[model samples]
Target: MEIFKVEKATLSSVDDLKAYHAHIRPFVLQRLEEFRETWERGDEAVFEELVFCILTAGASALMGLRGVEALRPVLWSATAEEIAQRIHFHLYPAARAQYIVAVREVVRNELGGRLKAWIESWRGRDTRRDACVQKFKGIGYKEASHFLRNISFRGYAILDKHILRSLHAFGVIDSDRPPSTRNRYLAIEQRYLTFAHQVGIDPDELDLTLWASRTGMIVK
Candidate 1:
């Protein structure tokens, strides 16, 4: 569990990232803030949010939305094959479908269909993210962070490829490879938080800023 601290940015790319982050900070904050209202809803919406993360694991956010929008009703009852036929994920449809099923199963059996109550029970980043990691299927650190962030929670980083590559471009991380272990993921996340703090950007808005800067679209 020897954590490797990240190197500071030295590339010319750092300036560009700073400029881009500045422009997108307000917009990303707006989007994340919209989720605060979702918490007022119930567990059905919470389950739907979990389904979004499950569908988006190795796919685009748009593809995940497509699956959620197209198969909203069938999500709880459909077989993996059925979901595969309904969505156009273009990557591991059956597997993602199975993941969706697995998520629903876990929420029903483990949480007793009280996903919202269970999630809101945790008061901090460590407890909430760890609870998500322990209870959910098809969700590790990155996915857990993404889900929590989308639900108006702060203090977690989504270490997806776009953010990783942006970090590499700025000479933050060495490579764009996904962190292979929990300790590594959290270590990198801490490094990003440190960098965000140094730059005076809110930690929660950090992912959206990088993502929007790279992809030209700000989304969950």
Candidate 2:
């Protein structure tokens, strides 16, 4: 099957964000507002944002937040190694300690023993989204999407189960199997980018809105 390139659209300001929000369902619009509020509050530090993304990968936002809350004490009072140890122990009971450790190592190595440095490096990178994601540990397409969407990376689209289902239902893509590999995910990502352009919204913003709507946290 051939996938054609989707023409990109431009959105330049807050007014653009609001206008795009208005075109979505009320539930989706409400969630976009909520996500924008929450995302704006914690986007000050890129490393912290990435760490939050790592912790939340494969988990719902609420669940990820709980994990972040659990690690906050260590984040405040301990070194990175100490924080890693505490998180390793804390998540051990949940059987996800290894993945957490993997992510910690990736961040540590990529940042050159300093979290701040890693953030700087990430912000400086000019590679494609998938290439950037490949540099991180335990971060495949889905995890990468979760991380990128939260940070509002331009032109990136997330492909979680709900989003995939929604896309299929809307006839945006025809697929029987879920996106479980890099190539498959990229294909779906292309579809999502097309849908976003057609709907006149940023792909990442659209993802946030969809997540919020599906999770039922779209406030009136």
Mark the 10 consecutive residues where model 2 has the least summed lDDT: 1-10
lDDT of 2 at 22: 60
Q: What ranges in model 2 sit over 4 Å off?
A: 1-20, 23-44, 76-95, 113-128, 218-220
> Per-residue alpha-carbon lDDT of model 1 for 102-192, expressed as tens digits?
8888888988998888888998778889889888878889999988877777778899998898777766788889999988998889889
TM-score of each: 0.87, 0.65
For 1-220, candidate 2 gives per-residue lDDT tens digits of 0111222223344354356456444545444455445445543344455556666666655545555666665543455455555555343324344455555566555545454434335553234455547666556677666565554444566676767765775578896356877778777888888888887766765775554434434321
Off by over 4 Å in 1: 1-15
lDDT of 2 at 138: 51
